[model samples]
Target: MATLEELRKQLDTIDDQIVHLYEERMRVCEAVGEYKVQSGKKVYDQTREKAKLADVASKVSGEFNKKGVQELYEQLMSMSRKLQYRQLVQAGALGRLPFIEVDSLEKETARVVFQGTEGAYGQAAMKHYFGENCNCFHVHTFRDAMEAIEDGAADYAVLPIENSSAGSVVEMYDLLEEFENYIVGETIIPITHTLSGLPGAKLTDLKKIYSKGIALMQASHFLDEHADWQKISVVNTAVAAKKVLEENDPTQAAVCSAYAAQVYGLEVLADHINNEKDNYTRFIIVTNQKIFLKKATKISICFELPHESGSLYRILSHFIYNDLNMSRIESRPMEGKSWEYRFFVDFEGNLANPAVKNAIRGLREEARNLKILGNY
Candidate 1:
């Protein structure tokens, strides 16, 4: 009903108004961020957003629809929450209010290394944790990621530790022991493994499937469901999708994120093909820097206990004695120790505190091979 010129002009006008609204919103958001900082309240508030959405929805009527208004306001509220979170996080220690000087970022920005290909979860984690302004080089193996950091070829390395459906990455834990680095932060990403194949490929035509190691493990139920298809495991989930593109084989498909399907130019044969729908992977951001977390956040440490009776109990007693809660504890068999085991633990409290420091000392006296993984 309208000419292209008229449509373009209307869009330009709307864009200008949108930009003005965004600027105004940010002005208020900045003040809210300051208020939150002063009050020591969290930046994100779901209840506040729900109330806002309901208030906005109540005002709309007629053709606009109440549900539509609620949905639109909910999205806007989500953006507001994110903006506030970023503001608080940026204001806390990095941008302004210099609690800790991270001036070494530029000095140490030689190179960044990560595990897997461009669209892998590790790449996303690296970008999410270290900011997305720079290019990151990816390695094929987790060991190579550690080796790069160890050999000074890379300033930082990203590795995946655990997944929701499949649980802990035993290989990554061992690699952490073999190669040491400080975990600067931790991130959890929701996994959405998509089954994709070459263009025009149909589900019945699929003979073989490709997926990353973690995805393969997560989607083991898929293998069981489709017992006829041969499985090929790759280094990255997105790489598997990309391999389908490169190979141009209609008979084979790759399991990866639905987002990767579009990224790699593959068509999705199945979405959320993981064994469980709500699969998520938790990755620790390992860096050489000794970064600190917020008050409520916990720090991780790796240690080992001898094969004596109550050795684990004696080490845990130190945590109990100090009234420190252990968030997580994992054990793996130590190399060359037939019955002995290594313990990886995560506990609340900063290691900078005297009590936590003494607790580590007590743990050191008890643990056979105790390593402070990171302060946060």
Candidate 2:
């Protein structure tokens, strides 16, 4: 066996050769990119890529070496594809995106709808985004809010899409995919849950606690401290407070926002019982039209992956190639399709941006049912 220092020296020499080869490969890829641009041909060629992968893998000896070489080349090719995509963008070869760009969201005279009753977090988010005096109404369910927008009963709808400590509002994601709503803007509100009850009710008098499922989970530590308390899921925390007051039961309390409790004429029994002190819930302003603001800096999209190996990696390569920063990614089971999932992704860029255009073009060509949810 060679000494450790001798092996290190040899490895360094091999790395130098690899770097030089990599530069040469990139130059060739750039030439190919130029050719494709001139020929008006598509950037992604799946048939050619598959053949290349197979040919390269066949040259390796052992199974381990074959797999390793294939993986390495997969990454290298993906990087090359990204470089080509960038070249196309710089050369003004990327085409227009599907979404219509708007100067601004209609807020002053627009009618808005929100899920849950008055004093709900959705209401607060709507007010925060659309000004305190904006025209808005409440709906009993998130679906109802979506329907309101779909029916043109409202210009926009405010709905929660995610929470900081408790993770995503998954139902909202499903609804977005199910409906034709487009997210135009997003707002984040700090969440501080409190246990509230009737004025004379004590902690000992509480038999059941009602709140949204996520809110209950966020306050799990505090609720767990009192194991005897029954937990009930409601539509929203504000709705739970409304129920507590309507029921007029001292035995029932609500785990809700302080504003909700106060608005519903309840007294706070405990304050800030959430697991994380800096918990926040992100709300999206959605509309029925497929429009985005011209100044929008973030985009959300969803797509279903083909049921084949390396499909996801191939799709993500578009983002890598365009140098787009993906902020969040989530997956939900595709409706009516067992064991198959649809993915939702949020990335930084506008629809009008060349890199964004390049990424979306490649993704639309490759992924199934690629939908641009919004640019905000």
Candidate achieving the largest lDDT: 2
For 221-277, candidate 1 gives per-residue lDDT tens digits of 866787899998876788898889999999999988777788788888877777788
* Number of colliding residue pairs in model 1: 1
lDDT of 1 at 288: 58
lDDT of 2 by residue, 1-376 (tens): 9999999999999999999999999999999989988998887788988899899999989999999998998888877777777777778776566679889887899999999898899988999999999999999999999999999999999999988887888999989998999999999999999999999999998899999998999999999999999999998899899999999999999999999988999999999999889999999999999899989999999999977788887898788767899999999998788878899999999998877887886787678999999999
Cα-based RMSD of the predictions, in order? Answer: 20.5, 2.8
User: Would you list the C-alpha lDDT of every candidate in the order shown?
Assistant: 0.73, 0.91
Indicate which candidate wins on TM-score.
2
All candidates: TM-score: 0.68, 0.87
Model 1 residue 199 distance off true place after TM-score fit, in angstroms:
1.9
Clashing pairs in 2: 82-321
